[model samples]
Target: MTTAWMNATIYTGEDFAEAILTEDGRIKQVGSAEDILSSSPDRVVDLNGRFVLPGFNDSHLHLRHLGKQLQSLSLSGTKSIQELIVRSRQYLKDHPDRSRVALTGSGWNQDQFSEKRFPTKEELDQISSEIPVALTRVCGHVAVVNSRALEVLGLDASTPNPPGGIVEKKHGELTGLLKETALDYLGPLYPELTSEDLRSQFQAAFSAAVELGVTSAQSNDLSGSNTQALAIWNLLLDMDQKGQIPLRLTQQLALDTFEELDAFFEEAKQPPSDHLSMGPIKLYKDGSLGARTALMQKDYADCPGERGTDALSDESIRKVLSWAQENDRGVIIHVIGDGALERVLNLYEETEDPSRHGLVHCQISTKAQLERIKEIGCYVLAQPIFFDYDLKVLVDRVGDELAATSYAFGTLMRKGVSVSLGTDCPVEGVNPLPNLYCAIARTDLEGKPDGGFHPEHAMTLSEAIRAYTAESAFQEGHADNKGKLAPGYLADFVVLQHDPFQEKPDALLRNRVVMTVIGEKIVYTHHGERSTTR
Candidate 1:
């Protein structure tokens, strides 16, 4: 059915337009309210002067992780080990089922600990000596387990470190900390999540994304050594095909094993439906700043003579890049530290194609690298939410001088790089507007370190919106069909209660999404109470 939305302030992402008419899920006209309404659509929505913009496209997100996190114990806001323990204890008491319990949560900062250490087995043992509990850090790159968990996994000091991971141990005993691919450290002891559990988490994740106004997402960690996650994703895809999957998704195929990656490249040549597309083959160049695993060219100022290690070998990275280029797949490399950034640039240079793929977290790149990215025209999908959380860690690790250079969004955009923004959800939380707030504020929530962190790198509100919307679509090679609110573009748009560009930078966070429409359907609306058309 044809629909017309009038009395709206429309942002086409290229120009300011007024009113819009849609038919068969494509914009049919863009003109004055009176002129468009003359066509007479099946339904007319008087936007009542609300601001309308293109629906947001999340370039990088873990949909399954988001859903699972909701059902798991949330330790995201805990400030100390004691607080984490208290939170976990309270959850267990509420559930009261130790035999079938698997505690999962995120957001624990090891560097912020009183001892500047990771949670030891002793601390977790004190909290629940009976349950197998694993709490991941905010980054989801590192996790700490309790003695009960370790014992359940049969992991001990004698367990050899798996490839691409590390087991933090002290006194020749497993300290319950797993880093990188070594998460298998507690696997044998951990209970496998039932298919029923995964299905529930998948639905929860999909529901959460739709409620948040996300119609499409490029899901990371789809195919990797993480067998369980991959299987769950397959189930999600099956449900999607059956039309049970409520959200559209693009799944990233991580190149963990050569054979598996080769198989993926073969399968990705024929793209799937809009509901499911093969995303880039993801690779991790370094760890996160929160865990001090992001490889840096120079030693962390806080820890002299210590530089983080690269998650993968240079040769392995080159091989993956070469293969992706030879085939038609794309690459999304995660590089947070300057050292990692340098390596990715060098690899891209060798590949000799600026558009072969994109960089996930190009947080710290040099002037030369920035210029090179512009020259090559690669997408730099950055997460500004890290500006606050990782900034604190950066300040602590590399000192104020280096922290000021982290998450350089404005710099990349000004240099003509294809800059896009995302929440990196669950890692940074699922909210998109707060990310917009960070892009403009360019500082932490409390407004720290006067003049903002890297004031020169701050993005204007308009720029932030484009990064979250238009540029995000460009990242996934959907620029023509998505991003803009122009004629012929998909009828995916959101009506805002306030104009983000017109509102004060700080006040943008206070603004809410009034209504969200995807594919000519109202997926979410919040007039007086929450409602959905899905």
Candidate 2:
């Protein structure tokens, strides 16, 4: 069926238009209302002159984790260890169903804690001595579990740290702190989710995403270590077959080793339909700065001789790269530190097809590295929302000189690199407004560091919007058919409460997605009402 959307101020990606004609979930035409509406169309949607743009496309995020975060205890705002304990205890009291699986909570950062230290295993034990409690830091790179969780995982004093990870030890005893690859050990704690549970999670995440104006996402859910990863992929495939996926999703394969890669390909044969498809290979090159595990060239400003560690072994990364190159697959690695970023850049220089592979969180870097990335012409998925947290501690963690050059959003775009924006959801949030605020405001939510932190690096409102849309679609290798509101593109778009061009940067925080339409369907609308007959 063909649908006509008219009487709207629409952003056809590069410019403005008044109407759009869509058929078979794709844009057939975009032009003046009088021109397109002159022709008969089966359906019509009047946007009421609402400012419209292509639906937001997140270049990198974790949809599965976002759903789980919504379902479990959230320790996000926790400012004190005592408060975290109180919240956990409260969650237990409310649910009282601890037998199904291990207790999981995330979104905590010790940097924000009043005590200025990580919550000890003993402290988590207070939440539940019988139940295994595991909490991940906001960066998703570090995690700490209670003593019981350690016992459940069969980890102890004798247990040694695994490759690219540290099962932190303090005076010959496990601190129940795990970093990088060490997080894989917690797999046993994950209760095998049934097909229904998996579907519910996807549906929940999709609903949340569209409400925030996200029409498409490139997410990392298929991990090498997770045995149930294939089942999750299958669930997505099944959802697409039934047109159940509410958002366009491209799964990033998170296989770190050769064995994992081979095993995954052996079982998972074909990609899904339009709503689902497989994208790049994802791997972690290092950890996060908050945990002092983001590998850097120099020692951290606060702790000398304690430079962060690497998450991917050189041998493993090289082998995987070789395999990917041979199989013609794209690879995107998580590298937050300059040292790690430099190594990945060097490795990518040798890539047979650098366009297909790039880096995620290419944050801390030098001017030379930025220039190098531009020359390579590869994708760089950055999170300006990270500045909400990173700005508060960047100078102290990475030192003044390096911190000054970090998160060069505008610079990358000007230098002509394939740059895109995302929140890395469940870490910051999937909300694009806060991310846009941080990008243009160059400050945190509270508006700290007046005049904005490193304001020079801040992206213009137009630049940020395009990064979240066109550039993101480009990142997932679907630039031609997604992102834009141009002819031949997917009929996915959002109607906003404010015309961003006429508003101040802070006004974005107040901006709301008045409506969201995907695949010629009005999936979400303000005031809890959806309409397609308008």
Candidate 3:
């Protein structure tokens, strides 16, 4: 059936269109309402001049992980160590029958806490001395678990440090702080979710993405663990083939080693679904700035003589990159610090990047490093929302000089580097509006700091929108058809209550998704009712 959404202020990406004609899940035409109406469409829906744009494409996120986070207890904005303890206890008290074997929660930032320090396992023990309690830092790189958890995992001061990870110890004693690979290996040791439950989680995550106007995502759902990662991948492919997944998902496979990757290449089936396809491999090079585990050239401003943890070694990463390039695929590594970027760059210098490898966070770097990135034609996927949290503690973490060049996405764009925007959801929330606001305003959701934080680094309204849409699709090799609202493009667009082009930046924070359309389907309407009259 053919349909025309007429009388709408539609941003057809490059320009505006008075009406859009869609048929068979693709745009047939975009022009003046009179011109489009002349086509004699089967149905007409008058939009009364609402703001319409291409549906958002979140460049990077953890879909399976985010789904799990939705079910797990969240302590995102908890501002005190005492509050962290209290919330964990309260959640257990509130839900007596949730999970008895292990209690897991995330999103606790030590910087925001009143005590201004990492919560020890002893503190987590207050939640339950019987059950293993593990609370991850907001960055997802660091986690603090109770003594019971350590015992259950058979980790102690006597245990040797795992490669690419740390079992953080102080004064020759166990601190229950696991950084990088240690946390990754032990994180899945908790009671596993059933296949049925995993399906539900993915559905929940997809619904949340669609509700926020995200039409597609390059998600890193597969963990480094071999068996579980492959299982989850197969499940996702099955769901995609069955049309259970709503949004387009390009998987960024995370295999722990070359052997695991080889096993995957040999055993994995190529999915036939358009919505589910292979993306670049994801490698972790460092931890996060908030966790004080991000590898940096200089010692942390707050903690003298202590740079963060470097998760990957030159030897392992080189082998993986070689494997990826040889297999005609790309790799996007998680590099958050200047030192980490340098380390990755050195490897790229020795390799031939036919698929153009990328840096996930490319967040902290010098002007020279960014210039080198541009020189290498390496694209970056950045989270502007990270700036919102960094604004308060940046100086304390990286000193003024480094902080100035850090998170400079605008600079990268100016230097001819392709930069795409994302929320890195579950690390932040999966809301594109707030992430867009942070990109445009260079401030937090509340619009803090009079002039905005590093205002020069802020992207314009059009630039931010493009970064979230066209640029995102471009990065995933889908710009030819996805991330645009035009003739022949996918009929995916969103109607917004507020026009970001004309309204204040804050309006984006308060703006609502009036309608979200994917192909011919109206998946979400603001008022919980579909109202497209024929």
Model with the higher TM-score, candidate 1 or 3: 3
Candidate 3 residue-wise lDDT at 319: 95
lDDT of 3 by residue, 132-186 (tens): 8888888887889999998988888898778778888988888989887788656
Residue 142, model 2: Cα distance from true site in angstroms: 2.0
**Tens-digit lDDT string for candidate 1 (1-534):** 778888789988877777889988778888787878788777887777888888877778777778778876778767678887898888878866533656656767765665567887788887778778888887877898888888778778898877767888778888889988777564554357677777788788877777666777887747445554456556766676777665567777775556677654444333345666766888889988777788899888778886776898889988887777777677888898889988887788787675757889887665566677777666788888777776666677777665655677887888778888877888877677778888888877666656777788899888888888888888887888888888888888888888877877777677777787887777777757433211
TM-score of each: 0.93, 0.96, 0.96
Top candidate on lDDT is 2
Q: Cα lDDT for residue 380, model 3?
A: 89
lDDT of 2 by residue, 1-534 (tens): 788988778888789988999998889999999878787888888777778899999889999989888877889999999999999888888886743578888899998999989988999999999988998888877889999999999999998889878899999998889988889899888787778877888888999999988999989878756456687887888888887888889998887777777777788858536788888889888888888888898999988998898877766788889999888798999989999998888888887878788789988998788888988877799998888888877889888888888899888888888789988898888999899888888888888889997888888988888899999998887889887898888899999988988888888888899898898778889895444464
lDDT of 3 at 526: 81
Please identify which of the two predictions, 1 or 2, would achieve the higher lDDT against the true structure.
2
lDDT-sorted candidate list, best first: 2, 3, 1
Model 3 residue 311 CA deviation (Å) reads 0.6
Over the full model, what C-alpha lDDT does candidate 3 score relative to the true structure? 0.85
Residue pairs in candidate 2 whose N, alpha carbon or C atoms collide under 3 angstroms: none
Q: Write down the worst ten-residue block by lDDT for model 2.
A: 525-534
